[model samples]
Target: MIRWAASLGLILAITLAAPGAHGQSPAGAYETLRLIDGVRVLMNPADHASFASSNVVIIEQADGLVVVDSGFSRADGDQIVSYIRSFTAKPVKALIYTHWHNDHHQGASQIQAAWPQVRIIATEAARRGIDGPARLEGVGYETNPAWEALLAGQLRDVAARYQEAAANPENDAWRRHRFGQAAQQSLDGIPALVGTRLTAPTELFTADLVIDDPLRPVHIRHLGRANTDGDLIVWLPNQRVVATGDIVVSPIPFGFGSYPGDWIETLGRIKALGFHVLIPGHGLPQSDSAYIDRLIAAIADIRTRVGALAAEGLTLEQVRERVDYAEQTAIFGPSPARQANFQSLWLSPMTENAYKEATGVPIVQGQGELP
Candidate 1:
């Protein structure tokens, strides 16, 4: 069981986490967060991407369970499947690819091996994205589990600091938001990321499609481009739940592949869907209306901040820090840490460089700091 803690009169609290009771490091242990009765989200951490955390969701349907995104490797996939098995014996009926990022969909091969009948579904762009040349050659976790383990400790410490701040009366609301935001930011820097052979999808689509089962009727719609050029939203009209890929991570939206204009428009589209339970690619699920409001506010703030940086010709690092993720994070909340999380996957320099060149700015080389 997950232990949540807080202390009195302390503005800051600490959440002490231990390795899996069975002796596995915290990185391999899959912490399952049940979103609802039949829906669950998995948080997998690793030293990859500087030891950040990643998320995956599994939805149980009447026919079989539908997996939203897979984890980083066969090992990670096995851990996820093991967690699912602990809950129910149902096989995966369908594997849904929210986007083609490896962290989001690399476990398909293992899952398919277990459930060959499972159908693979994703957007056309997501399909190609998974099969692209940039695919990982091998696993990310085993590359440096020791160092990754050390990094995971730091993230845990960061999380602890965040929790501590959240308990302070004066910092309560603000710290909670920052904690969440920091969670999202911390996800990008994990170093233990294991590269994967990649499990590609079998089917793809370009338009809105409906996933109907006796259990639920999910309408998945694409919003031109946001998190990626081919991002999509999975909506459960009846359950009033929606799975928004990476388009809307907690604390703030990941802007690596973001077309600011399109991202903003996508937020409007999500709001129009009116899902009460909004499940983001990372972070906790939120209410549809409330989340839509939160998204709009955060994205607008990012736009304003980035726009100012662009106007002033500030570099990406200067630009990165100029846009205070802390404020938005304080308001929205933090995401979990995982290897190859969206923070690393989405915040690629290639994407950012492209965005800059497209906007007529000089290009820069390197991962973190902008030129």
Candidate 2:
């Protein structure tokens, strides 16, 4: 999803998933996936219902729990707090953000409320973005009323689109009604997001930061730029579990303002980590490099294609029309919903960033997108 696209911005993350549900979804709001003895990922929040959030991971050390990706809204954080309380009474020691995307870090306030002493950590660059002016009137959206109104309005607009589609004889009646219901489901989440405070990470490191433990040691590394300028991946050597923020999202990836070559190399480095269990920012837990390998190939394919197309002097939109990775739809579920997700969330933005790389255009954060 383009995190800060000009017209729609983060709203696309939800609306684009129209018929507003995951094609292959977790039955509950969030599922607990036990990687080893102490590692758990509170999987996808099917219960959130509106905006999509990154998967919140819980890693247990001897004394306390270490969490990755606090989630999108405070309500999401509340669900996470309840989810954690349902399992254990261990105090949360640290809340780590993989990147600065709103879906990954906006819920920090709720977690902070739960564990007042929880150390919120991010890479130096990510820390800047935690409080960066991503959207709205030159400020982050969580605290921006206009941005929130714009988002709610966009979802409403989508609902109207579906409603109109339902009445049209040209579109499928069943599809329209199904999608309309989904749009409404997303709109139902408006109240939960108001007055969200964008809590910035407290601690920062440029390269590596470690939270040492006898049982489960966390080795946090900023492995180049992938999903964002400062992307953090948590590696627990003892447990053999690695938490990849948005650097690796299962189901489908988000390519907004991502670095194509850097992302490919970063994933390659992640593949070399020899992790027994990989918890992506969203979706289910991964066991091997199969998904990582596929992601690498998919990205390389787009980079190569876009580089070649741009060499021919075609504009980004022209390149977009000429480029097609629909074959990847087979790799990430060929359902209509999945296809839309793959193209919009991953393909479109990946091609744009790769084009910038090839043409020597600066891909500024929150700038290379729809504005």
Candidate 3:
């Protein structure tokens, strides 16, 4: 399902057959998937009904837990805290953000409230995204009261749309309605959409940062820009598990604020890591690198095809029309709904980015151009 909210600067696309909602308790609002002894994947429904499409990873240590990706709202953070408490009484030692997307880190405050000593780690670019004005500028908006009002209104509108859609008997509509209800519920807690004390990263790194502990040794690497300019991947060498935030989303990938040309290379580096299990920022975990390969091929295909079209003096619009993604569409999902979602969420933005890169135009969103 594709829903556009100009006020929020979002083109929300919820995928089908998202991980089922389980382990729901007053403490955590998401489902938990235990990959190994100490590593648990806390997944939000991909249908977007819960408005928590991002997954939170929990890694157990000797003293406490290390969490990846806070979530989307204050309520989400509270649930995460409760979820953590339900399992163990240990405090969260660290909170790591894979990127700077709001959905991944907005709930930092909640986690911080519970574990005051937790260290929030992120790439330097991600820290800027949280502390600076890039988020508003990236979306072509300015940070101000008007912007906040627009976002609040957009959330309300989304809630209403979901409510109407939920009234339908169709399964997809019900999912949309559920997502809308969650969006509405999060409004009271999210403050303003952009411009707030967004629990900035306490620990920042440029390329790589390693946490060497006796129990769980974490290797955080910023491979290259993929999903976001500061995209980072968490590699648990011993566990052989990798947490890719939006960098390797399942079902369909997102292309907003992405570096298509560089993303392919970044994926290559991620593949070299040889992770046995992959936990994405959204959707379910993957046991192999099949999804990663598919995503790399899709982006590379877009760059090759769109770059050629753009080099031939074709405008972005023309390139979009000329680019053929039938094979990819089939591979992703040939159904009408999946096709629409893929085109809107991934294809269009990717084409534009590839076209700009090929033609020597600055990529607007991740170019560090702030107002």
Candidate 4:
């Protein structure tokens, strides 16, 4: 599912991306990183700045190419296709969606259109969730899949808001600077969203599946639920790299509708995989477990703190006030501005999610408002 994170407007940032292959493209173009011999990860340019796309991985196999996560919009899909064409002449044989979030899977139609015979793969739950209640509530998915036009029409209003914020003297220099950049990033992505259609997975599996190849075999398995009910991890065993959807994000993690305790176990499962390089859903590729460890610790801390406060009959707001994640938040960044992001983006929902898990409250799936 895509998030209108910029609407928060309090904290917007750009992640440090790996240098793009060949050379740097213009702004709004995703930066590229060649992880190994055959795999290249396209880092989202609008990350943390606006409603962004997830990192896209293109894996070259013996006969054809296999892709992980399509992108956020049709424009993203078109750009990915051009990149694929430039990288190799081989057709894309399969495209894998790690979850039901549109940011991760919304651009599938363009890729499938490029290669008509391409088999789009996802967990059976993700396939159902794509059109089912579990899918992220976005403009360009399920029945109301006109997100391109919908968002484009609303961009002017959003830009006006940014302009107003930039003019406000009360806002700090950082906010004004970030607002200008965020507005441009959102505007630049408008062309890509046009003509994009909602696409669902063509193939589904209940658990582990392997796309066998002599040079670049891909092993996919569904670890326990973390970000969503149906989460898949693509393990490139030979390369010792794993593409963990939103289950693992960098700098800040998403806590919407997440299974707190189960997410911890799921991260543990990923850690056991022993990947030399970790490709997160967003942000740059990681080679160490340091970020993962911090994520695990933060989730556990919030869940435990929330559960304990709830057991004592403390209300959600009161618990939030009482809980202190400053030490943990500082791990991602020490500045107050960065801490605000870690709090809103990660801590806030995570606390509620943990409380819900402990108190047996039903958390609604795919219910956030969209542009």
**Each prediction's Cα lDDT score?**
0.56, 0.73, 0.70, 0.74
Which candidate ranks first by lDDT, i.e. highest? 4
Better model by lDDT: candidate 3 vs candidate 4: 4
Model 4 Cα displacement at 346 (Å)? 0.7
The estimated TM-scores of all candidates read 0.64, 0.86, 0.83, 0.87
- The residue pairs that clash in candidate 2, if any, are none
Candidate 2 positional error at 253, Å: 1.4
Q: What is candidate 2's TM-score against the reference?
A: 0.86
Q: Write the per-residue lDDT of candidate 2 for residues 158-203, one digit (tens) a residue.
A: 5565466556776455545545555565566666666556787778
The runs of at least 3 residues in candidate 3 whose Cα sits more than 4 Å from the true structure, single-residue gaps closed, are: 1-11, 16-28, 46-50, 132-151, 160-197, 366-371
Candidate 2 Cα errors over 4 Å, as ranges: 1-28, 45-49, 134-178, 324-326, 368-371
Span of 10 residues, lowest total lDDT, candidate 2: 19-28
As a whole number from 0 to 100, the lDDT of residue 3 in candidate 3 is 20
lDDT of 1 by residue, 1-371 (tens): 00100000010111111011112234344566777877787753321111223467788888778888775445566777778788788888888888754456656667877888888889888765554423332223223344344434545665555555446566446445645544443443343233334555676788888767887766767877765667888787777888887776653345443565667788888888767787777555776467667666666665665666667877766666555555554543443421112333323332353336445654311112211
Ranking by lDDT: 4, 2, 3, 1
Rank list by TM-score: 4, 2, 3, 1
